[model samples]
Target: MGIRYVSYRVVLLITKKLGLLKNKFPTKPKQSTFITLADWKDTKAKFLIESREKLNFPKTPNKKLKEETLRILNGEICFFSYDWKNIGLDYNWITNPDTNYEYDIHLHWTDIPDFKKENGDIKYVWEKSRFAFLLKIIRFDYHFEQDNSEFVFTQIESWIDKNPINQGPNWVCSQEISLRTFNWLYALYFYQNSNALTEERFQKIMYVIYWSLQHVYNHINFSRIAVRNNHAITETLFLAISQNLFPFFNESRKWSEIGTKYFEQEIDYQIYKDGTFLQFSMNYHRVVVQLLTFGIALKEIHNQKFSKVVYDKAYKSVQFLFECMQDENGFLPNYGANDGALFFPLNEYDFRNYKPQLNTLHKLLTNENLIVNDDVYDDENWFLSNIKFENNYVPLKRTYGIFSFDFGGYYLARKQNSFTFIRCGKHKDRPSHADNLHLDVWVKGENVLLDSGSYKYNTSEKNSNYFTGTSGHNTVSLNHASQMLKGSRFIWFYWSQAQKAMWQETENEYVFEGIISAFQYLNPKTIHKRKVTVSKNEELWNVVDEVSFANTDSMQQNWHYNSDKIQFHTIELQNDIESYNSSYYGLKEKGEGISFSFNKNITTQIKYVEE
Candidate 1:
């Protein structure tokens, strides 16, 4: 290994060691403190004991937005569809809700009279039911829509009775607890004026929030990673929200103080200087945006203000969200870990469309409108309702040009009818996928070549590896091996480094040239180079791959692409290349791919004729 490679290894090892030893977060609590509330006399936590008035969710002002929200509320059996397969939820059981919760969650979605489970895994069902609590709150608050207050309270009562303090699947993860606590608090506020919210019921709900907060307090360390990414932000946002909204307890003050500090710290740390998320996954980036937007909205409604740095990073983050969209309908390049997590699924758009979030963030920060085609998006109604509205400001500007984010390792060449996004950078933070030098190409708003999204986090080991491997991306792979060495399911032993080595353009044609070290999983002396040239009209494109190695015999190089939007048999290939691709997670489709055997160089040309 060269001195540079050795230095990289040493840095990573030292980083891991420091992460393991870091312990600034709260220590795990004992059973005795599981349900305990802070003492009022504790001056250190005095702010938590102050009174907090409830805030209202935004009422629909735009007719189009209102109708959509009402349609979803009335038409669907469930307010939100948790399953992407369009499966119906079995409110009686948590499993698939449509089918059943996972075997381990040990809890049901609804309050079944005889729900029994010998073993429970809390992480399985808690994430699904997270919005369930908020849905109940909405149902009761909009009484004209539907008053399921009794059912909602019964479900809460059953959940409290079934899942004891710090026991079973529900209490297993502090992050889940933190999320649930935030939702439960909102539900309480939404239903505060309802007859169903009795004094006894209110206390029970408060007790649940208190207990959940305690769990989060005990396990805060789990959220505080060396990178301090979204997990840590979620925990801190929950703490800050809890402090501001549920200031009935004595601990709220300390939580507010510390949580706000960490919130700002994470905003500064987890968000890159270029406004990209540190995780480098578009979906996780969206999650961070949602968390930041929600935190900022909550504080704004309560008259709590973060520093200008927090607000500025948030605005730039939203700007990045807008810039990263690859299509007209707002579909982002599914270039990273995607768990089908939509923080607020108020709108019925596909998970890939990020406009809802982008518009929401725009409205929150600027106090101006973005003139979205529709107003009643779930995110819009939810977030806009929290803050006061101002003059209409439309910022959705479309342009055909080149955009480069060096820090994020993304280069985009866009035209009125085409887009080419290239990924050619090494990770400054831990990478979630083995994709290096991946390219996402789109024509006429349809993706011609793309990244296969993460289907499931946990499945058969082979399937999980397939979706995350280098082969799943639109890139060249060596001997059917990933560019990086897989360590654990989500980690790579060594990261590949790729850079935009050259870029050239003429009136009718543009070229993007890049190179990546593919030696991590192959011969240490091998290097792979790629050059892509396309016409301004997007009618013709050429890709050239060159491999430099001391010994080329018996080495295999392959390139993959997607054919979902196009007929596979129609495309002309300059070389006798085979094809393979994937549509969803954990699944692969037979498509054309190029392969070279013991060759130093190969070139492929793709021509697009008018249909």
Candidate 2:
């Protein structure tokens, strides 16, 4: 049988078995069951496509975090921490849901505080690990006092036993926060020995460990789902493997088989062949690095040999991480608000060292070349390639036919001295940017046709005109319609691919051409041709689209360019529009190729590293 048929059948079988095809991708996840208490409002989410959109100072906000950690340590949050059991519960009933799911409810980041209002304004957000890590510091600062032991147990029990809790739902078995609870319960049972054991606690501990292993470490469907990368998914994978905690859960033979099953397929979802993970956020990339460290430590502790696939993938993935790291305004672009606690001191240590992006890790290297130490940062791309239309996707069968093209743009070093990039794609997608096939080049660091990035997610009403829709990007705006697939879910999902992205050299100029399929409704035989040329002599670039939508009407197209700085350009439209942009930062021009310019001298060179 042909590899395509065989490979396709494999995916088809898996999806069929999982029943995933039957389930429509949710516009928003049902959080009442998984995350919080209620559905969010348009007041909160501010789905921005309505506005052309109008559009951060951070210097290791770590010092303030350290101070708070110290306060929690001194027992300040709970006045006089003498066995919190005595204190009547001020906060109770996380929720008393009518629906039922039996929950042991071991809290993972329970140490952190929830959303709080201060001085008539919402200030500190209740993020998962950041606040939780601080709480652990507070507890440690007290030196594990004997008097406070009751307080910890009572509070943890009350907190954990709440009606609603968060852990991926694999409801076939009992619904318990099995992973974190295992650690919590294990820590207490073996506090004296600092190791979880004893014949009595063994079986129960095994059950929890079994659940953790099944979710991320198993071959079944339970492992496929993910939140942000820092949702502690990677940490869950490593906790079992690195702790040599396997025997306590399952036997040696069974453990090895299951362990191999967990990673080989699952890792593909995280690390692309180019070494990038699906989630584009930088903080998550950092999380992946730490996970790799734990994975290595795991192999040694368990004395098990990982498959060559896992070893080879991890090594190559590090290369991808280093390539994506850059010096934006000094820190990685805050693509989206990321809230995770530092595994170490942030001011003094570079988190990148945890899985340092050097060509190879050395025995002699002491500290890491911090994300801060790296001279480049890209506000444009949060991760390597946010959402990819890639072929040559995997499996040796069709590697030759495999092609990877991104609507999301990339950062390139021109002549190895300056940085220029193209920004396409959004971890969140929109229908109204001119940046569909838009190429924004910053030859030697100048704001050329660029991506007009988002304004705000929290405060929507006013900023809407500036951040949402076609005018925010650099693509050709056909009518007021967007080039993207619309609706809120479109912001998060895609259904098609870009084909024939051939990169070639014509002695002095660089050439790239591909066909972008809007990923619309998956009707067969639909194609849109896009071509981009960057000339060495012109020191200029031109992008053209001969896009033909097959049997579809009123489709919109746009190109977007995002940057820290805004560009001043007049929209000299040759084609007339029904109406101009209703909001700011958008255009209403409808037609074929449109040229928007930035009067500046720049250089964009395209060269490839020999594989």
Question: How close is each model in CA RMSD to the real structure?
Answer: 7.3, 15.2
Tens-digit lDDT track of model 1 for 272-300: 77777777788878888878777777776
Q: Largest lDDT belongs to which candidate?
A: 1
Q: Could you tell me how far off, in angstroms, the CA of residue 255 lies in candidate 2 after the best superposition?
A: 5.2
**Deviation in Å, model 1, residue 294 alpha carbon:** 0.7
lDDT of each: 0.61, 0.35
Q: For residues 1-611, what per-residue lDDT tens digits would candidate 2 score against the true structure?
A: 23554565577567646856323222122322211111211121211011111111122224444554444444433111111111123334221111222222333222222222211101111111112332343223232332233344444443433422222122211112332442343234223122222333333333434444443333233333322233334434443352343343334345445544555555654555555555544455555554454444335333455555655556545544444333332223322222222332222233322323221111111122224333222111111112121212122110111122242333332433223343333333113222344454543333334444433233333333323444444544333434444343114224334454555657775566656555344335555565556565444455555545544443333433333232322333232222222111111222222233221111222231122
